[model samples]
Target: MNALLIGAVLISFSSVMVVLAGLPPEVTGFYRLTGGGMAMLLVLARAGKLKLFTPNTIKWGCVAAVFFAGDFVFWHRSIAFVGPGLSTMLGNFQVIPLAVVSALFFKERMPARMYAAILLALGGLYLMVGVSWSGFSADYRLGVSYGLVTACFYALYMLSLKYALSKDRVDALVLASAAALVSGLILGGLALAEGQSFVIPTLKSLAAISALAFICHAVGWFLVTRGIQTVRGALVGLLLLLQPTLSFLWDILFFGKPVNPVELSGVGLALIGIYIGSYTKRKKRTQ
Candidate 1:
């Protein structure tokens, strides 16, 4: 499979896998990262490339992990206040922050067409979530606030990971392992402080959590990190629309959610935007 396709499939599974794990958010996050980290460590050791703890690697890896852990915590909490669909849609606002950061810090030039593509993708995402603007409760407002915070941390994580990958000394395996290790440690500590049990409640839950760790966290994110090395940060954000879009389809198919025509149309628009964004070429600077 192509890198984009791999990334799309992996990310699409992430939310669903979290739900299937059926644990408290912090505990789920901890296991997912720990399991993934251990798996990556085994892979690195087998390949005789485990010597990946250089100063630059440690610095950027920990930075990315911290942001990722924050993103996970806020987003999972938002899901309790708001429904997952709306929370996910709001969390995806990371694209805006990512675009701004890229322009200011990375100095990566964006084309006009790219901006149009981003707008189209976001519009489609808004529609896909079927957002209701009419009602606002305190809880819902709090959830929205949390979701927005999740977006900021998520954007930072992506940017940090991109920067880490750009260094010659860092590879995808090491970065993924380091991120998972640090995130797991931080989240595990939070889970304990919250008095959440670390033990899996059932064999079924254990299986699900293991799948999340190995498949979604280890394999899925590994491919995504590798893919982002070739793809731009802004474009990667646009491409991740596939995750929520697919998650919507899963809900409709398995969870007995009523299908809406408007939302279906939103899926079409999101796909079109992804295509446009993927193909849009940056104009070359004339020296």
Candidate 2:
């Protein structure tokens, strides 16, 4: 539980890092992937686990990489336009699409709670943006759009990665590094085409990027994954909620994101909805 708490806290800093880096979204994503990838690769090398890169691993890793690249692009753009709190919250909308996919393809039946959860979340979103929809800046609207795009891409990435992990005999760490490096290369190509410089301007930005790589990606996720393995299923959902919840708070505290009573209520409502949707009920066995 301590690991999970610390991990969530570190993950919450992800948007803070992106904001502080002050780089283009692609550039920020490039650094995050390459830096974190190389670090994880080194660990795998030290552990003599580099041989785990089966052909199956590479194939699925590439597939997952493509979706993740899309996720990074739109999510970073959303962060730039809307600030971290709302953008991160919007990304959590992945649950809706994921639930739909589960029902349609996997033939899994969603509980009544999921329908109510979706309504609650959408209602909260309406409060956040729909109320002042006409008055919002073009960039704000685009940010929200990018955020929803991020959710779709994020959901696809999660599904592909989950399938790979479940079916392949690859080490989780190896697959992660491969996906990161591949995605980083894709973003690198895009960055070059856009004529963006790889040169990070300030030392402060470098530090932020470094933290994004090592702390948020490498260490924080590692801890969260470890915690998930040992923790109860119900607790895992609640514990993981800490990441986006703190992210919203961090934006308010650090970036001075303006919020009113209604928006605040919306945040609370949306978070509750997300939590409810995220929780999977475990069935009991008959004796």
Candidate 3:
């Protein structure tokens, strides 16, 4: 639980890191993945686990990577427009789609409470984005859209990575390394297409991005994955709420963003809805 809490906090810093790095989204994504991949590779090689990369692992990792890259692109873009706190909160909507996918494909049963929870979450989201009959600004709407798209991509990444890890044949480090490498290559191409420079302009920017990669992606996610193994899925979902809550705090503390009371209320409601939606009923034992 402690590790999971630490991982959640570390993951929350990613959006702040991107904002602080002050680089184009594509470039930021590329550098982050490349650095994290290299670090993971080194760690895996040192542990003699490089030989555990099977073909299935590579294929699934690449698939996960593509989704991850898409998530990063949209998330960073949304951050620029909507601010980190709202964007992070919006991105966490992946849980809704994840639930839908599971129910559709895996025959997972969702109780009535889950449906109510979903509605509450959607309402909360509407409030968070300041959407109403009066209408929202175009930029705010676009940012909201991007953040939702990010959730979709992140859902796909999580599902694919979960499947890959379930195989148990490949080391977690190898899979992470492969995913990062593939994400880096894809984002590099995107950067070129967008006419963004690949070069790091300043040492500060480089250090910021490097820390994002090493600390957020490599170490944070590693801790998360490890902690997930020992925690219940429902509990994990609840713990993940910390990421966005802390992200909101960082946005205010570090970026001097103003607090919106309505939005903060929405965040609280959405988090409650997520907790309710993620609730898993345990079966009763018969004596």
Candidate 4:
């Protein structure tokens, strides 16, 4: 039930992020993340759950900041090269890398049935993005590259979080605050260096971005961290599928983007794979 709730929240957050992709990715990432983190900080302070930063918390937070920085940098560039839809789908392919990273570094294991499910999920991923192959050679190649970088860096971030959680029982808000500070300073500098002007957002965009900050960056990321504390990295990778699937839905409903047979088939397979993966694992635990 917790997993399902986390999945639902992640899907909603993914929809929000895709919409915000129109903004300069770096500046938008900074504001959305920093604002959201700040809001949580306030909540933590009010509740007196916020913890003081020891060397350990700060150390883990900074490591996570590196991967976070990489994800924003690369994934945003992916959106610029590929259209938002394909960019999103491809960027999400990082689940493969994440699972590998977990298995290798963290020795994270899963039931054999769940491992089979992972392969099916990857095959589904291929189908999901393969539809855009028509007249999409150059852009597709670049998008795949950017997306792969995003995935690899994300794995690093996931592993770092796992390490941090293993070390201490810090508040989610505290870790978020630390990450926001480090990520913001690094990415903010890059944005300035690139001359990506931080223009004032229009009313609509501001409202949208604010929702993004609170719902996606803050709440969504927090849930992700929470899930990582209990679930293995491979499982977290499967769950990240929520991002693209939800983004696809948003495109359909809000943007009026139509889907065809190929896309639907791909989505169907991916959903089935996720179901299979989760079920296989759950069945084992119950046994």
Tens-digit per-residue lDDT, 1-287, candidate 4: 36534744554554445465457878877776677778767766787766566677777788889888888788777766654555566555555566667677778775676577678767776676655766567865777678768867876776677678766876555776787778877788888988887774577777777777777776776666566557654565456666676766766776666677876787667666655554422223443
lDDT of 1 by residue, 114-141 (tens): 6886888678766755364345577877
Q: What tens-digit string does per-residue lDDT give for candidate 2 at 1-287? A: 88887888899899999999999989899999998888888888899988888888888889989999999999999999999998999998888888888788878899999999899989888888888889889999999999989988988888888778877656787888889999999999899999988899999999999999998988887788778767777888888888888999999999999988888888788888888888886556479
How big is the positional error of residue 246 in model 4, measured in Å on the Cα after superposition? 2.1
In model 1, which runs have C-alpha deviations exceeding 4 angstroms? 2-7, 81-86, 125-131, 136-141, 223-241, 264-287
C-alpha TM-scores of all predictions: 0.81, 0.95, 0.90, 0.79
Total clashing pairs in model 3: 0
Error of 3 at 160 (Å): 1.3
Least well predicted 10-residue stretch by lDDT in candidate 1:
276-285
Q: In model 3, what are the clashing residue pairs, if there are any? A: none
Runs of candidate 2 exceeding 4 Å displacement: 282-287
Evaluated at residue 123, the lDDT of candidate 3 is: 83
Candidate 3 vs. truth: CA RMSD? 3.0
Report the Cα lDDT for residue 113, model 1: 68
Query: Considering TM-score, where higher is better, how would the candidates rank from best to worst?
Result: 2, 3, 1, 4
